[model samples]
Target: MLKKQVSSAIIIVLCLFLFPTIISANTNEQLELYSEAAILIDAQSGQVLYEKNSQEKLPPASITKIATAIYAIENGNLDDIVTVSENARNAEGTKVYLEAGEQVPLLKLVQGLLINSGNDAGVAIAEHLSGSVDEFVVDFNRYLEEVIGVENTHFTNPHGLYDPDHVTTAEDMAKITQYAMKNETFREIFSTKELPWDGETWDTTLINHHVMVRDGSYEGVTGGKNGFVTEAGFTLVTTANQENISLIAVTMKTMYDNQVYEDTTKLFNYGFQHYETDTIDMNSQFVDSEDNQYKTVENIYYTKKIGEIVEEDVTTSGKLVIKGEDGRKLVEKKLELVTNKEKEKQQIKNETIYQTDDNREQHLRIIIPISLIISFLIAAFFFKQTRKI
Candidate 1:
């Protein structure tokens, strides 16, 4: 059998030579952010690397538009023409100057809503997708709660404006951003630096408002969203990638706009610098001391700090549990019991795989179950970001 150990090693080495070194913070206290709450996690694995008051509910401001944009892309036709209404045309705060009765494509509105932070465009999208903002709210929250699995977020309007009930936690926002980043359409629009907008009442270039993303000052900064209101203070969500690992950072309720940026940067640095994600090949099978066989339903991923030792164990009930060297549960996955037909399929996939030499060393990385034991090395770097005053 031919093993993929060589190829995986090559990929790791190439990444080391490509990106510059990033310094990880020594402790959570080292990250000094003005935002009241913040969180950072591995985007692909959904592993939380660092968090501060992450679950505290607070106003998300325009960050709510991230939900709005992704929802529209999934539920509405991008090419559909939408008739703008008076409410949308008259939306306050930032806007694309949508005119009453003016026709616009749903895709264009989403672009304007995200790239330019157009409040009017968000209203237009809500009206077009669900008839009215009131109706949009009911379905919108359901999509977020049911589809995205965001528990602590409740968006009252398509455009995140000041509302006491329109709130989300930093953790929930990070999860939402993580889910949105998976969609190619959402990712393309989220990372867009600039776009040309031809509106009924206004014509201009829609520039991304995320300072670091638009200015290209931060490395690996792929996508971002900025939000603020008198009530919400300032909020932000940012995504970045380093090597094979991607990170999602969220900061909420900073006194200044720059502080939110600062908090997000700190989270990114901590995540990218300290953690790395490892994959569990779907073709790999596992066995326990009792000789029960199991396999993952699909490719699974988990993130861990550099040089941290972890353990992998398969239960009799077909569950995979990953723990730290100290026995703390880090990640849990449900495995599938090996059956006659399933073994044949897995055998076909693993035909070319052969175990290495007797002296081969295996490091317990994240949660991949490629062999009888899931073992691999993990390492990375992170930096703290401060919002510029």
Candidate 2:
């Protein structure tokens, strides 16, 4: 039992000391980015692969429509015909040019909002769904915070016009796009290159504003959105998939039109070149020196640099801490105790017998010596007593 206790304590200490800190960068090389705020992340694991001022809040411009589109898809009835209002007709910036009182499906407006960067379409969708732009913005912010897990975003309008309060961070926008891309309807709309527009005033093709998606600039470009305002600079969000790994890159407040794209490409190349996903299967079991079995309850995927060593530390309380090559923690999971009923029972019986045998040997060593010592002491005591008498 003493040996067993010492072994368990050593195991715990080794686990804690093996990886003292988390490794953030897989490589020492850094990408020079022109954007004020930028981030690249593994879409599946939500692990930040690279970042520069990712939490800096700036104008998101038309990329705000990405949030608007997904919110509409989830909350509004896409098939319902929305009657265009005067407010929607006169909405400023790029537009699909909807005439007042024209009947169009909510889904079509969403398509136009994303594909064309149509501010008018954004206004129409907002008004139709929430009855007013102000109310729609309230719900939009709520969804961004509570549903999408973005904290630094605040929207004053659905169209991403230059309102002082309308702003978001590159990381937050990336998170929003990541969540939106999960929906089938939103993904279809986000990646569309062009669609036929049959509006009363604008009867032409609505082409995607994102050059990367339209031109296939990259091999696996799935969807992208770019935005601009005098205050927000140039903001871009792009997602690409290669070799089964999906990545999201968001850049904000780049001074030049092309800088956002350049920063995005640099980030993407860095992630694809250096990082990889390692999956931990839930059913995989570990056998310790004592033959104790342990398994996780669910599967987890971790992103690490290529050729990095991944290690696992299982504690006595059943917590499994996973570390990357740089001694950074990648994931922690609670392991479940697995029992092989017959095998465990037999092992317990064997352990009990072994302990009993050891105890008997210990008793022989201790009892014999103590009995002889007692006999000597009693003989000495009686001799002393007789002399005194």
Candidate 3:
């Protein structure tokens, strides 16, 4: 019985050694996200707060208008009056009821497209800006991928109508929305809940289609767009500002409309309650303990919890690395010494970092020798102690 008890104790100790409990900072317990894909990001800092299958490509529906609106505002002359073609008038799905040959300002079309979720306005703007839908699609995709720096999104239409190949991820949509929210014009149009419309066929007050933004059920929402089709389900993109921090949330492929909003709200609440965006002024000089002055290549933002402190240091190679509490890198920038010195005078404890495979060899060169010396010292100490014994 004594032997059996000892063996059980030994087995329990081994199990405890093999498995350790892990604690995560995600306070909402990963959040019960209902949408198939969801992502929340800091608008100013572009830091990801929470994500659920964020990179999975899914149909974006009308949130694609966010991209279209920004593109039109930047590329097309918004003041130019564009003559509506028959193709625009005939555009399927939601529309502003623009009549064929009706002249409308490019800016007005963009407003109509975003406010009323007007498919016709999208087509009109697309045709006016690029001369044809096919050509517009090529340019739009390029802008989404190249200009905005999103990789998974591939849009075939400006209006986000169902095309088998027209798909974007929730993460990509959030990034696109973040980029659009930077422009004052796009922000105004996006946030406009109600606008008086004087169109050839439809003369009424155009209201934002997103129920949450239009009805004011959710506070702090600056602007939002929601969409749905049989193929894509329900997709929603919302931008909100609270406590001076801007947040963007995107949810896609939800079977029910309410589920999408629920997921978005959860994401936003989790982000706002836990994290805040802060920036490092590259213009400011950083002085080390040894009095070496350094400056960053550019200003950069990072998101962290209210109480968590992020660490930053300049490497020997003049690289600035910012890391979270878990030692995960948030961003890196090149650093320049104010004195134009060729060498770094001090190395922090972070020099032992092996964050990436590419740096494994470099870190190993530093770690292996130190480990060997420590082991040799320990062995020598034990030998002396044994001899004394």
Instruction: List, in order, the clash count of every candidate structure.
Output: 15, 2, 0
- Where is the poorest 10-residue window by lDDT in model 2? 19-28
Give candidate 2's whole-model lDDT: 0.87
Where model 2 places Cα greater than 4 Å from the true spot, the runs are 1-26, 281-298, 315-319, 333-389
- Each prediction's TM-score versus the true structure: 0.79, 0.77, 0.80
Q: Model 1 segments beyond 4 Å from truth?
A: 1-30, 339-389
Per-residue CA lDDT of candidate 2, range 1-389, in tens? 99999999999998777654323333656788898889998987788888899898888898999999999999999999999999999999999989999999999999999999999999999899889999998888898899999999999999899998888898899899989998999989888998999878668988888888999998788999989888889988999998847899999887899898888888888888888887888788865445567887788778887777898887666667889876988877777878545578899999999999999999999999999999999999999999999
Per-model lDDT: 0.85, 0.87, 0.87
* Candidate 1 lDDT, 1-389, residue by residue in tens: 14588888888998787653332235333578798999888998898888889999999999899999999999999999999999999999999888999999999999999998999999999989899999999999999999999989888999888888988999999899999999999999999999988776688888899997899888999999998899989889998988868999898898887898877777777777777788888958998666768889888898876666779998777789988655767789998887544567678666635333222334333223554242332211112222332
Q: Using TM-score as the measure, what is the rank order of every candidate, best first?
A: 3, 1, 2
lDDT of 3 by residue, 269-380 (tens): 8888888777888676775554567786677788777667789877666667788777878777777778543344223223434345538877899999999999999999
Candidate 3: Cα lDDT at 50: 85
| Model 3 global lDDT (CA atoms, 0 to 1) | 0.87
A best-first ranking of the candidates according to their lDDT comes to: 2, 3, 1
lDDT of 1 at 381: 18
Spell out the clash pairs found in candidate 3.
Answer: none
